[model samples]
Target: MVDNSQGHSAYSEDALLVSRMNVKPGGKQAHMRDGWFMRDGVKVIQQMVYPPDHPEFPNEPKGMKAVLAECGLSQQRLRGKCKKCESDSLACCYKRILELQADFQEQKSLMQEVIESMGHLSIFLLKFTAS
Candidate 1:
């Protein structure tokens, strides 16, 4: 006979089992707050919490250097140029190169198709002339 008047069963063991079932198998859960993770004894930031101009992360040359590195451009070759100018020039040049490559591939495919058609036509003509 269990007491049902208090909404909870008379067996406290059932409540404990239910609570434990909700918990993950990990040793401890990491709590996230404001883009930070508290794991074990360490407090870690999930992202760049500081602004670019912050002393820990300088804004000027580092950004340009990162951009140049990503674009595979040499900083020494573009020493005097502004970041925007260099980036724009690189973007335009890359776009032109990509367009040229696409055009070359299309022309190559078209040439292959033409060559195959010519071979078929020549074979047909040779057979017709022999007969």
Candidate 2:
């Protein structure tokens, strides 16, 4: 139960889950509270500060670079400027997620082809390897 100037309401189980997730592991006390989900907090902060489709950031890579700079991280991983950047805010996340999914699917397909080519020899090799 929590009380405020407005009123009091019963705390739900979801509230408990949220509290537990924010707690640091091993009971170590942390002054700075974090989000319930374990993700890139800096990236989340950057996203909040400079949303995907912000006017200044019509381009995704530029916006991401700016945010990374603010967070004191070098943009070594980001490739050169993108010629065609998505304008829609939702589309930004969607496009990157789809690209990642496609890459993963391609890798999975390649792995399957390799496994198929290995055939019975792979199984025999696996059996001999130490557990």
Candidate 3:
């Protein structure tokens, strides 16, 4: 007869492994992702502060003046004072977050594939050794 206790122990170990790999909602992983987004947003804002022609931001998107105009904010108005400008800024940040998240997911998928392959190899070795 198969040992029920051994089966149960194996099942518990698998469960633990899965739980460790899964990211819970509102958990530490979520907080870390949010923090990364905030950091990226800050970087975007800092980049916006420089003009496109400025040596420091040669690739900047037409400068903050153009961005403000695109968002329908007058040059004299503060970004916080204009709802459209704030929304546009948030949209830019959100786009950046989405791009980063996609790259992260791709890397995670690759890592998971590697892990699964290793697990298969281990299982094969165990079976070969047992036989």
Candidate 4:
């Protein structure tokens, strides 16, 4: 992993002490988390601003896991079973979600595979003309 510390000194664009910018390592987005070396040092400072879905969600102490669990319980019920009417609508929705996730996973495995199968899936794009 590349050292991406903002550095002890600040300088211009052409400075020699420049750091890496969100480069992926081992084909994965690398988290240059200082937590590995420094315990409890991951706390945010005054000037720095974190974004949504940045692991540390803004203004809410409850983490993403808590948030997602709350949402699933309230919205769809995490067990993928219907809360109201004990209906299979929830199961159907969850099944569709799984199908879409699988499709996306399959597409990400090889870009060419999606291109080869574009003729079948791309039909949705022409929804206006499709009878």
TM-score against truth, every candidate = 0.17, 0.18, 0.16, 0.18
Where is the poorest 10-residue window by lDDT in model 3? 28-37
Question: What ranking emerges by TM-score with the best candidate at the front?
Answer: 4, 2, 1, 3
37-90 in candidate 2: lDDT tens per residue?
A: 113652242221224566753322223233334445433544423345465532
Candidate 2 residues lying further than 4 Å off, grouped into runs, are 1-44, 48-55, 58-63, 75-131
> Could you tell me the lDDT of residue 45 within candidate 3?
27
Clash pairs detected, candidate 4: none
Q: Cα deviation of 18 in candidate 4 (Å)?
A: 37
| Candidate number achieving the greatest lDDT relative to the actual structure | 2
Per-residue lDDT tens digits for candidate 1, residues 1-131, read: 22223232232221111112212222222221122333466654432122465675432222222322333442343332233343345333322222222222232222234445677421212112344
Go through the candidates in order and give each one's C-alpha lDDT: 0.29, 0.29, 0.29, 0.27
Once superposed on the true structure, which residue ranges of model 4 sit more than 4 Å away at CA? 1-55, 58-74, 80-98, 101-108, 111-131
In Å, residue 45's CA in model 2 sits off its true spot by: 2.7
Candidate 2: residue pairs that collide:
none
Per-residue error for 59 in candidate 2, Å, reads 10
Kindly list the per-residue Cα lDDT of model 4 for residues 10-111, writing each as its tens digit: 333322110221111112212221111112554322111233555543422332123223323223443331233233443333322322322222322122
Worst 10 residues of 1 by lDDT: 14-23
